[model samples]
Target: MGLFPRYKRAARVAGAAILAALLAGCSGLGSKAPPPTYELMAVQSFPRGVGPIRGQLIVAEPSALALLDSDRIMVRLANGQTEQLANAQWEDRLPKLLQARIIQSFENGRRLRAVGKPGDRLVADYQLLIDVRAFQISADSNTADIEIAAKIVGDRSGRIRAARVFKVSVQTDSTEGPAAVAALNDAFNRAVVQLVLWTTRVI
Candidate 1:
């Protein structure tokens, strides 16, 4: 028993919380609430009458580096340090979510003869390959950064037709769970729109 018994108790509680957080990553089983989850949606409307390009297209699962590959919502601190959004996460893996929404977007375009995933076992005329370059929000500012690279290749000939990279920035203003996800989804929709439009012209 020390003279400052209450101070000792507070220190012990704080230490325990830190330990729990370390073990559980950002979302701990401590008194704090569970982290919220977010998801990206496909753009509903695409340019119709896109000059009658017809082909079966398969969208591959996008490739991303370790930092942008996880379900965690990524953020870069003001000091250029990287961390996740402590209160939010993606509903699914980033790549999986991107692939699904992209497929949906192609279907929304309604110009393709067909759109399938690699697992669909369909003979496709062209394949749309995507790579995730950067997708993160800066904590210093409420701006989200997104960069994507894409390649269109002939499935039968195995020849590359076209390739391009896309970059988009969006100011979310609301930092936490409320508006951060909305901002990210907006950026994704816009970027994917371009990717779709470019693929239409190339293929």
Candidate 2:
């Protein structure tokens, strides 16, 4: 028929236009700005170590759910749904960042003769196991909540020594990226401070 070739030509033109649009969209995505990066907060100073530096600790990378494990900052809505905070991310994966900060906190506290990850090869007295339960801005981003369970196990005996959960909440002044993160930092600082105090007292 006379019309067949005409219809085929139009279809080719339309397909070409669609392909061009998709390529443009992909290019736009590739050109988008990178998200801002943030670091986890750590306790700066701690009460002087008691009698002597006795305990050696190995801080394991924390265990976390996939939802909380990503570098993306998360906010839990009042409706109990979670969403990533727009345009911001962590400097590293959540567990990795937290683990480093925890080691810093311990070293700063000076209660341990040595502290490091499993790779450190320290002749450790105890190993610290951590499980991250929640780390997010909650209640529609107006509050920061952090929770973690920690356990001390005898490195030589492979026996549990002590265990406890730590949790803290700090009210946010604003849900904006910087302020929200500040609040989270405050909460995390509080939690780690308590964790340090407890660890020193126990072992």
- For every model shown, the clashing-pair count is 0, 0
TM-score against truth, every candidate: 0.81, 0.84
The positional error of residue 166 in candidate 1, measured at the CA in angstroms, is: 0.6
In candidate 2, stretches whose alpha carbon ends up further than 4 angstroms from where it belongs are 1-30
Error of 1 at 122 (Å): 1.5
lDDT of 1 by residue, 1-203 (tens): 57599998999999999998798874544557668878789989976664775888999999999888889988888898888887899988999999999999988987778998997988899998899988888878788889999999999898999999999999998767868888888899899889888887777
lDDT for residue 181 in candidate 2, whole number 0-100:
89
- What is the C-alpha lDDT profile of model 2 across 1-203, one tens digit per residue? 99999999999999999999999999998897888998887899876666876788899999999998889889998888889988788899999999999999988888877999998879988889999999998866489999999999999999999999999989998765888889889999999999988876777
The whole-model lDDT of each prediction reads: 0.87, 0.89
Lowest-scoring 10 consecutive residues by lDDT in candidate 1? Answer: 25-34
Native-referenced Cα lDDT, model 2? 0.89
- Quote model 1's TM-score: 0.81
